[model samples]
Target: MQDRTLIFVLLLGLLVCGAVSLTVGSPLPAADLLLAAMGEGDPRHRLILLEIRLPRVLLAVLVGWALGLGGAALQALLRNPLAEPGLIGVSASAGLGAVIALYFGLAGVWALAPAASSLTGAGLATALLLTLTRRGDTLSVILSGIALSSLAVALTSLAMALAPNPYALSEMVLWLMGSLKDRSLHDAATAAPLIACGSLLILTAPRGLRALTLGEDTATTLGIRLPALYLRVVGGTAAMIGGAVTVAGSIGFVGLLVPHLLRPLTGHDPARLLLPSALGGALLVCAADLAVRLLPTPQELMVGVITALIGAPFFLLLLLRRHLREALP
Candidate 1:
């Protein structure tokens, strides 16, 4: 199928999933509440639809879009199919930043503290990555990212270990697991600007990435300005991943899985994959969020957990299939 056709289909799927998300939740006939909310006639319906569901749906769409785009951009820039948005270590740092906020009881008093602090964390982590990767090689990025993740994870664990109270610890743990439930419009608003900036930064690098598939030296020979390309892609990834974790906690797999799924359809060209990957990611997260609401579980499952559950097995299958093909030859 043509890239435009595939993207059109994904957009339609996203719309269908979004409609189901807005209309499928509790008290049944949320479609009525949706209409009432739009009509502005019923305060209670307005509260439920406007306050509860709309923001969650928006954040789901935005976060998914950011992750998917960031993932494809990172993979293309690094010339590594295995690379993901979090490979820059911003997500871990952002989560740690949120934990620090909750530990200090700031989130209790201020609704935006976690988001603010997490964005700061993401910025700091990105700065650290740039400092370490001044030479702008892919290996340096991978290594710096590993070091940053380890340090952030260690600090997060220490904070949990030294939590002043069980409530703080529980909150930290739950937030780390990630979810889109109970998010507010303010959270959605906060994430949108940064996600936009990051996405725009990433979108600029696809031509470079396409050139890169020829090899870094060849790309450089083509006047791709390797250092500037790295700067743009990394900075953009940090912003998007940071923004995503701020609102959704730590949802995973949308970045890694969506691109791989869409790659073959896009003929595996980095430039060709971006739009479809972004659309597919949004559709995946929106549908997953809706599924969590509909499932007959004790509690609404964390969407992050749901993605991890699906993605880990998918990764294993990917490896096994690759291995089997090699063995067959």
Candidate 2:
């Protein structure tokens, strides 16, 4: 498909999925829910529509966009289809930060404390990643990221193990599982600025990423400032992924899944993949969240669980395809 056409379809999908998400959890008909969202329905319905579901929809869109855009940027930077936000430990570190905040009761004291700590953790992880990896070495970068991610996950587990009470441990575990349920507009507002800033930074690098595809030497000769590109991509990804982990608590695979699915439609142009991937991510998350609500299971699945179920198999397919290609030649 043409890039513009693909993007348009993704946008339409996002709109439809977002509408479905808003209407699914309520007893009211879709039309009535729409009216309630617009403040024209019963007071109780209005509260459910405006206060409860709207924020969740909005958060899903924002988180999806951030993850998708971040993933595209990271993949372009690493020049690897498998590259994702968590590959560099940003998400894991952010999760650790939030876990610490919850375990220490800082989250109880201030709603935004966990988010603040998450951002701090992401920044630290990025710094450590850069410090540990040699400049312009993709293998080193990935390895360092894996190391940092492992360390962060270990620390998070330690925090949970030492939780002061069962309630605290349960909260930590549930948050780590990831869900959009019960999120408020305040949570959306808290995450928006960081996600926006990170997106801008990521979007700025498309030309550079395209140029880098020809090789670093060629890109450097074309006057692309590699250092500046690295900084923008890393900083932007950190901000976006950190904000997402803060609000959604480690929702997995949206970043990885969206880009891989959309890249072919974008003609494999890393720069062109950004917007469509963002839209696709929003659509996927909205659809998945809606499914969780609409399904007849005894309990609604966490959004992350839904994504993991989809992504793990997709990941295996990619691996198998790579192996087949290698065997063919």
Candidate 3:
């Protein structure tokens, strides 16, 4: 898998999946769909394409891109094979904030309240993570993140336990499950800037991360400032994760799944893995969302649920393979 070929395939998949996404629930013909997409067909069909499907597709891509890039950055930064977006507390904290918004009826006052609250939580977690691990090594950073994640989960459970009503509890639980459904272009726009900025920060990581493969001491001798590198990677990851959670709730596995799948293609180069992972994430989410829409269930299946179903098994298999390999040697 040459990088060029891999990129081309990913891009083509994204385009095909995106087009398929817009037509998943449509009864219209392909020709009519094209007309509607171009603003020259039935108004109702056009509305569905523009207002309903378009936004959903955009959000799926954006969230996937953020998750994949952030995940790769975190894995490279920590030099850990198991690293994912949730390892940093962003998922739990963002989830807790969204739960708070819905649990207390804050969402009633403003439609975007949940998104705002989620971002705030992510920011706070990032701040706290940096503060706790400021002068510490990667181990300290990982431990601090785990601590924050634990606290956030505990608080979220408490909130659910004391919910004013079962309905409130249900709502909180659903949002935390993560989905790209019912999103709007506004949501995509809201998430784009943070994701873009964070991606920019992480894209600069290849040289440093490559050097880091030689150990931190060797990296330092090679002129890599470990502290600055850590800050850039962690801060960028937080921002991207925050942006993703703002719209998609707590979708997981894109970050965890994409990079590892592409590692062989990149020959284990952490830097080379980022772009492919991001593209692969987008393709997975788009295809998954399309699959969810096509399912025969009475209600549309949630994208988050589908990914979890896929990712959990893959994760277990990955662990088994890793342990087996170690045992073999």
Best by lDDT: 3
Better of 1 and 3 by lDDT: 3
Q: Model 2, which residues run further than 4 Å from truth?
A: 127-140, 318-329
Please identify model 3 stretches exceeding 4 Å from their true place: 319-329
* lDDT of candidate 1 over 1-329, digit per residue (tens): 79889989999999999877877766646556757767756677777788898998999999899888988988888888889987788999999999999899998899888888888998899999878877778999999998999899899999999999999999999999989999999999989999999888888777898998998899899989888888888888898889999888888888899898889899999989987888888888888888888989998899988888887799789879989999995
Question: After aligning candidate 3 to the native by TM-score, how far in Å is the CA of 163 from where it should be?
Answer: 0.6
List the candidates ranked by TM-score, beginning with the highest.
1, 3, 2
**Per-model C-alpha lDDT, please?**
0.88, 0.85, 0.88
Candidate 1 runs further than 4 Å off: 27-31
Span of 10 residues, lowest total lDDT, candidate 2: 129-138
User: Cα RMSD (Å) between model 2 and the true structure?
Assistant: 2.2
User: What is the TM-score (0 to 1) of candidate 3?
Assistant: 0.96
Residues 266-285, model 2: lDDT tens digits: 88999999888888888888
**Compared with the true structure, what per-residue lDDT tens digits does model 3 show for residues 1-329?**
78999899999999999988888885878888899889998898888888899999999999989988888888888888789999989889988988999888899899999899999999999889877767636897799899999999999999999999999898898899888888889999999999998999899778998888888899899998888888888888899998898789888788888888888898899989989989998888888888899999998888989988898899889889989999995
> TM-score: which is higher, 1 or 2?
1
Clashes of each: 0, 0, 0
